[model samples]
Target: MSIDWDRRHCSRKGHITYAPDEAGLRNRLHASTAVGTVWRCLRCGDFVLGEPHGSGPAELAPLVPRGRALRDLFILRFLAVERVLRGVLVVLAAWAVWKFSNSQDAVHQLFESDLTAFRPVADHFHYDLDHSPVIDSIQKVFDYKKSTLHAAAGLLLLYGLIEFVEGVGLWFAKRWAEYLAVVATAAFLPVEVYELTEKLSWFKIGTLALNILAVLYILIGKRLFGLRGGHAAFEAQCRGASLLEVEVAAGEAGGTQKEPLPVRQRSSTADPA
Candidate 1:
C-alpha cells in the first residue's frame, strides 16, 4: 500500500508550523480567519489551527524531513534494528564461547557420558551416533585450545561491538554513521563470501545479500565517496523537500513561492477544525 509519509510523520510527531518573517512567505504559510489563525505545517503542508510553533526568517526555518526523507530515515532505522539484533546475538555467542572455554573439560566429559547412555537408543533406531557429522563437530570444538577459544570469543565480542555502534548511529540518521555502516558492512563482504564458499547455506547467502544491499543503498543513496555530485547534491535534495525552502526559492526566482504552497483552508465561519 502507498503510504502518506508526510501525514504519517505529522501524526506521530505532531504538526510543525513556522512563521517566516518574509511577508510573502508568511502569507503563504498562514492566514487569519474569523475564529483564529491557521499556519501551514512544514511537514505535511496542511493548514493547522492555533499559533505557529516557531517564527523566524525563511532561511532560519528548520529542516523538517517529509516525503522521501522520511522514507529514507525509515529504511536506515530498519537497518539499524537488524544491526542491533545481530550484535546482540553475536555478543551472546561470544559469552557462550567464553563460558564453554572455562568449563571445557567438564562439558567434554558430560558429552561423552551422555553419548554413551544414548548409544543403545541410537542403535535401536539404526542411527550411527559415533560418526555423526554433528557429533564430530561438537567433539572437534572440544579439541580447540583454551587460548584459541578465548581468541574466538574476543573476535566475536569486537564484531558485536561494531554492529551495536553502527546500529545506534544509523538509528539517529547521522551522516557519519552512514559512512561507518558502509565501511564496516563492506569490509565484511569478503569474509562472508569466503564462509559461503566453504559451506553454502541459504542463511549465509541471505545475510551476504542483505549486507551488500545495505552497503550499496547507503553508499549511493547517501552520495558517499563523492558519487553523484557528493554531499552537496544530497544536502540540496534534502533541502528541496522542505516546504519553506521550496517557497523561499520560488520567491528568490521571482515567482513568489515559485509555485504556491499547497494549502487547504476553510472559508466558513465555523471555528477552525
Candidate 2:
C-alpha cells in the first residue's frame, strides 16, 4: 500500500502530509521563498514534505489553521475593507467640496433673490430673520472664500490618497502596511475622542473601539515596537514553525531518507504506503 500524499488528512494524525497555504507560509517564515518543497500543518504547525503527486488523494497542501489563522484572516480582511471604505468616503468629500465651491456663486445669487422675495412675507409673520439658525448657516456657505474652498478640496484629496494606499497595501498583507495602518489609526484616536466628547453616538463609539483594537492587534500580535521581543522574537517564532524544521521531524518519524527532489520529479512521483 502507498501513503496518500495528496489526501486532505491531518498531519498530526500521520494519515496524510499537509502544507501551509501562502498566507500561512508567509506568517510562519516571514519569507516564503527561502524554504523549498515544505509546508506546515494549519492545525499543529507540523511540516509536511513534498507536494501531492496525483488525484489519488485530495489536494491538501494548504492546510486550514484550526485556530489563530482564522482570527488573523478576519482582522486583516476587516482592516482592508475599513481602509478602503474610508478612502471612498474622503473621495466623495473631496468631490462635494469641489462642486460646492464652484457652485457657490450661483447658490448665493439664488438664495439672495429668494430671500428678498420672502422677506416681506416673513416680516408679515413677524419672524426673527436675523436670529434664524438655518438662514445663518446658508449665509456662512455663501461667505466662504474661493481660496479656502480650494485648500479644503486639496486636503481631502490628499487624505483620500493616503487611505487608498493603506487599503491596497493591507489587502496584500504587506508587513509595512500593518505598521502604516497602526500609526495612521492611532493618530486619529485623539480626534475621535474629542468628537465623542462633543457628541456621543453609537457609530462614533464603535469606530473608536475598532481603531483602538486595530492598533493593539498590530502592536502586540505583530510584535511591533519591541513588544514580545519585537522583530527578533517574531522571526524566531516564525522559524520555529517553518517547513524546513518540520521536515526534519517528519523524516525522523517516517524513518525515510529525506531529500528534496527536483520540482519535476516531485510533481511526477507518488509515495508508496
Candidate 3:
C-alpha cells in the first residue's frame, strides 16, 4: 500500500513534512529554502520547504532557514540576560523602599528644601496644591518640601515592580514579555532624553543610548526576524517519522521492492505542527 504523500504530519520536532517514507531524500532539500527541505506535498499544492511557521501576518522577508534560525535564537537568548540585570535593579529598588520607609524625617527635610523649586512648576502645570486630596495628604505626611520626594520614591517602586515582571517574561521566551519590554523601553526613552537635556553627562548619554538600543533590539531584532518560532519548526521538520514511514516499513516487511514515489512539492504553506 502506498502512503498518500498528500497528508502532512509532524516529523520529529515540529516541522511539517511530506512523503515521510523517502527519508533518504530528506537531505536532498535545497539549502536556501525556509526550513531547508525540498519535499513537496500533492495535497496542499504549496511549497512545504522554507515556509514560515506560525499564524502571524507575513513579515517583510521569507522564513529564515534552519541554520539562520540557530544563529538568531542565540542572539535573542542574550536578551534573556536582562533577568540578571533586573536582579541588581530590584535590589536597588528594595533599598530605596527601605530607606524611604524609615527616613520620614529626611523626606520632610527634602520636601521643605525643594518647596520653592517645586511650587512654581507645580503651579504652572495647574496642579492644585490646596484642593488636590493626594497632594494635601502628602503635605501632612512630609511637609510640603518632602512630599515630592515621597511621590518620586513611590513612582520608582512601581517602576521596579514592572521591571521585575518584564524580566521574568523575557527570560522564559514568552511573546507577551517581548512586547511589554519593547513598550517599557520606548516609554523610558523620552524621560531619559529629558534628563540628558537638563544636564548632558557621559553617564546620562550612555544610559539613554542603551535604552534606545534595547527598544530597537526588542521590536525589530527580536520580533521581525526572531528564531524562536522558526527554529522550533525546523527542528520538527528534521524528525524522521510520519504516516509515510509506516507504509514504507510495512512494504519492506512483505519483501516488496516498491520504489518510493518522487517527493512532491507542496504549494501551500507547511503548518508547523
Indicate which candidate wins on lDDT.
1
lDDT of 3 by residue, 13-118 (tens): 3343333223433322213555574543322323466533422211111222233333333344565565447646755865675576668777767876787578
What are the per-residue Cα lDDT tens digits for candidate 2 across 143-203?
Answer: 8898899899999998888889888877666667878888888988999999999889999
Could you give candidate 1's per-residue lDDT for residues 148-200 as a string of tens digits? 99999999999999999999988878788889999999998999999998999
- Runs in model 2 with CA error above 4 Å? 1-70, 113-129, 247-273
Candidate 1 ranges beyond 4 A from true positions = 253-273
TM-score, every prediction: 0.88, 0.64, 0.44
The number of the candidate with the highest TM-score is 1
- At residue 241, what lDDT does model 2 achieve? 43
lDDT of 3: 0.51
Q: The CA-based lDDT of model 1 is what?
A: 0.84
In candidate 1, position 22 carries an lDDT of: 72
RMSD of each: 7.1, 11.0, 15.7
